[model samples]
Target chain A: MIVAERKPIDEILGFLSKHQKIMLLGCGGCVTVCLAGGEKEVGILGSELAMARAKEGRPLEVVQRTIERQCDFEYFEGIRHEVKDVDAILSLACGIGIQTVAEAFPDKVVWPGVNTKFLGVNQNVGVWAERCQACGQCVLDKTGGICPVARCSKSIFNGPCGGSQHGKCEVSADTDCAWALIHDRLTRLGQVDSMREILPVKDWSHSRDGGPRKLVREDLTLESGK
Target chain B: MSNGKDFQPKIVAFCCENSGWLAAEAAARLELGYPEKVELIKLPCSGKIDVLYFMKAMEKVDGVMILACQKENCKFLKGNERAKSRVLQTQRLLKEIGIEEDRVTIQYLAANMGNKFVEIVQNMYDKVRELGPNPGKVIK
Candidate 1:
């Protein structure tokens, strides 16, 4: 899911200074799963803002609404009327949701309430770790389910470097050597021979180096004449 | 605790939708007034209550009560069970922070028990009134 964490209170307060009536929009999709921008979080942010404003003796009017998914237009439609009245919107969705809100409402000022961290899964209760980098490549079949691009601190393509010491990365003694994990995992699955095939240096041109990427599937597109 | 001004304890209650929340709504419908001091927030399941929510509530209110479905009857299978664990975790955190554990309370109730909901709210109000305003808030 799109993992996120709340921004500092001062930063949030700064964004709200100009707006007397503000709405906090929470997404129930990835943000809810990560427990960052859910209904509960909306309430907390609203209450915190209220308290802070009350302290300053400048009580602001704040309302909260949680939609099913902020990424979709249908869910965004639900709050269209409500959004018109508020001076500003504090989006509690991921980066995508924030952008979608901005695009959907060109006139209304939108502020991000949470920092979109990374694509990750909950390691356990309250612990989230990076799992995928979405580097426009899929090599999970060759390696184990883990992606070295995310698990490795350096995003190394091949196996462990010389910096690996006792199965731990030299960068951080606590972090596990991602390549070593892949090597051990491949050996257990009898795919050790695949490792000998020299992996050519990765081409940076196809990735984010060339700027934003777009995929167009001709078969899925509808011709204008049709 | 009587002063010249009427004392209304700041109590925040998190009620599970399957049980406690419905109970509170039912109690309200029946005109069974729970303590006016208690402000209730409903969750899909008490298990879904985040630690951040709990921490924020502790800062703003004098007392908190997490109301979940009765043991062995949670709609989400083990939601009530999970809520119990989180409540315990929050209790320890509050204690560690030097706030009395009694400031946070947890209870299990079936959705139909409107009377029980009122009783719980009244008990929470009384407890919080004794504690008075949150010490952390007072310090600030």
Candidate 2:
């Protein structure tokens, strides 16, 4: 899931300082599962912002909506009338959803209410950790399913870097050294030979180093657009 | 609604059925009284309360009190513990937005602790009155 956290309240307040009314948009995709930008989150933030504004005597009208998935253009169609009612939109979705909503409604003043943390998995109730960097590559099969690109402090390949101490990252005592975890996992699986294989230098172009990435599906693309 | 000497803070109490709710019923049967302005909202368990509900309650009331079972005494094992965590999280959210974190609180008791229930509520009522109206209270 795309995990995110709400931005600081003061920063959010700053964004809407000049506006009297705004829509609090939420996405029911990854954020909802992570307990961040869901319906309940939207309600909580909406009530807080309204009260915060009312305290200043400026008051604020919050039009709250949680679409199924804000990244899709069609999910937004149901709330077109709501968009027309507010001065701006403050989205509590991931970076993609926020940008998608902004691009879909170019005329509206759209702002982000959350900071996209990472592509992560729910480790436990109320806990999420990054699991993928979306490097346009998959290395899980080679690394015992532990992601070095995300879990390692340096994204080091074939590494328990010199900084790894006692199976923990030197950067933080609490963080497990990803390479150590991989080593242990591979050792347990009797696949230590794969770990010793010298990996080729990774191609950076497949990842964000090549700039904004886009996926095109010729099989799915409409003939008219082609 | 008067912000003067006659002011009464509007308070909402979410009482877990196994504890606070039964205690409040006992208090009523005993003819003990609490401020009418402090309303009681009964729920299955304190754990069932969500942070959203806590914030939304602020829209209608000035103060919120969660009445849950005592630590280690919840019928559902860790219900009160979860409620306590949620209350703390809710208060943190409140404080971040410049509202009094004390405006929301939690109390633990049993089905027979009627006096404690009344005592804590009266304390909340008095404290909220001193703190003045909730800045988060929505204007009509």
Candidate 3:
């Protein structure tokens, strides 16, 4: 899932210095699962914002709402009336959700309250790490379920670089070498022989390098003639 | 920072029912005096206090004291530890916004330690009094 974390209080306050009344929109999607932009986070941030402003003697009016999700227009439909009243929107969702809300309401200003971190899984209760770059391609079949593009510090296609030392990445001792993890995974699966396979230079066309990507599912779209 | 008036800092204390609440009761029974301006709130567990509550308390009071049981003695296993983590995180948040991080603190104690409870309260009262007042709130 996409992961995000709140921006610093000063930066958020700087963006809202001009607006007295604002809506804090929380997403119940990936951000909620990641514990970043959920309802509880919205409350936490709203209180912080209020305290910050109140300290400066600039009282702020906050309207908080947590929708089912913020990346889709259907979710925003439920709170359009509430959104219309606020001078601006402080979106506590990821980059995509913030953009979607801005696009949904072209007339109003929507500011991001969190920085989009990455596509990752919850490693533990309060810990998360990057897992996928969404390179728009799949190579897990060869890498034993690990994405070299995301895991490996250098995105090495074949195996560990000279930077791999004792199964840990040279970038940081805390980071396990991706190839080492893949080697162990392949060995456990009795597919160590596949490790010799050579993967060519990645096709960057599918990723963000080829500009913004789009997937139009012909089956899912309603036909105009229908 | 002096406003020419006596600075009787208003403190809010969140006490755990399993341990800290009992200790506060003991303090009351023993007549070991604590600050009259301090308000004590009882919770089922210290872990039940959210970061929002801390900020809210700072909005009105000069300081916040969280009283919980010692690590191994926690009735809810890891409730005190969880409260400690939140307190640390809340301190960071408070510091980020220019509030005195020292205004928020957590203390661990057993129910039988009523003297220790009074000591902790008096220390917080003195600390908060020296820290002036919560910049988060204007309690004039």
Candidate 4:
């Protein structure tokens, strides 16, 4: 899931200072599962803003709403009535949802309430760690299931670099050496020979450097008249 | 509401049923008295109390107190810890809004601590009295 964290309250207040009435929009998708932004979070943020404004002697009115998924236009269509009266919107979704809503309501001011962190998995109740860099490639099969691109301090394909000591990365004592983990797993599976095969230079064109990426399937598109 | 003395701060107490609520009930059974200005809302666990409830209560009350089980003693395990973090988060929000951080607090106690419950309530009442009424009350 995409994990994120709420921005500092002061920064959020700065964004909202000009507006007396605002809408706190929450996403019921990834942000909800990650506990960054959800219905409960929207209510909390709305109350915080209201209290802050009230303390300043400039009372604020906030409308709280959570849609099924902010990234989908169909869910947003149900919230048009709620959005009509707000001066601005504070979205508690990932970057994609924020952009989708901004594009949906071109004339209104929209601000991000959370900082999109990374593509991650929940390690425990409240801990999430990055698992994928979305490099537009897959190499898990060659290096065991552990991802060196995302977990290694340096994305070294053939690694356990000189910096790796006693299965720990040089970057931090708390970090496990990704390559060491990959090597250990591969060895257990009796596939240590794969380690000797030198990998070729990666294609950079498939990543973000290739400009904004998109996926299209003409057969699945209604316009294709399949 | 003033009572011919100094400002009587209105307080809202959110009590966890397993601990704080039981303490309050025991206190009542013993005929011990707490501040009349304090209102109690019982919850299944401290984790159920959201930051919004505290902020909304602040609109009408001068202060809010969240009473939960002590660390490592929560019936639901980690519910009190989650509540503590939420309280800290709310406190920061209050400070950002120019309100005193002391306006909201979370205290841990056991279900059998009836006298302790009364003592904490008294302490909060005194602290809030010094802080004065909530500034947000008038704006709301």
* Residue pairs clashing, model 2: none
True contacts kept of each: 0.03, 0.78, 0.49, 0.51
Model 4 CA deviation exceeding 4 Å by range = A224-226, B1-5, B69-82, B96-98, B108-114, B136-139
DockQ of the two-chain complex in candidate 2 = 0.81
**Model 3 clashing-pair count:** 0
- Candidate 2: CAPRI quality band: high
DockQ of 1: 0.11
Model 3 residue A31 distance off true place after TM-score fit, in angstroms: 1.6
Candidate 1 structure quality by residue, lDDT tens digits, B91-114: 765654356778777898988889
Query: Which digits, one per residue and each the tens of the lDDT, describe model 1 over residues A77-145?
Result: 888999999999999999999888888899999999999999998989899988888787777876776
Better candidate by TM-score, 1 or 2: 2
For model 3, the docking class works out as medium
lDDT of 4 by residue, B1-140 (tens): 44335788899999999999999998998899999999999999999887889887887789998999999998889899999988998888788768899999999998989999999999999999988878766442
Ranking of models by lDDT: 2, 3, 4, 1
TM of chain B, each: 0.90, 0.95, 0.94, 0.94
Docking class of 1: incorrect
lDDT of 2 by residue, A107-164 (tens): 9999999999999999999899889999988889899999999999899896988998
Model 3 regions lying over 4 Å from their true place: A223-226, B138-140
Per-residue CA lDDT of model 3 for B1-140, tens digit only, reads 46335888999999999888999999889989988999999999999987878877887788997999988988888999899999998899888988888999999999988999999999999999988877667333
The model with the greater lDDT, 1 or 3, is 3
Give the lDDT of residue B39 in candidate 3. 94
Given candidate 2, what's the lDDT at residue B46? 91
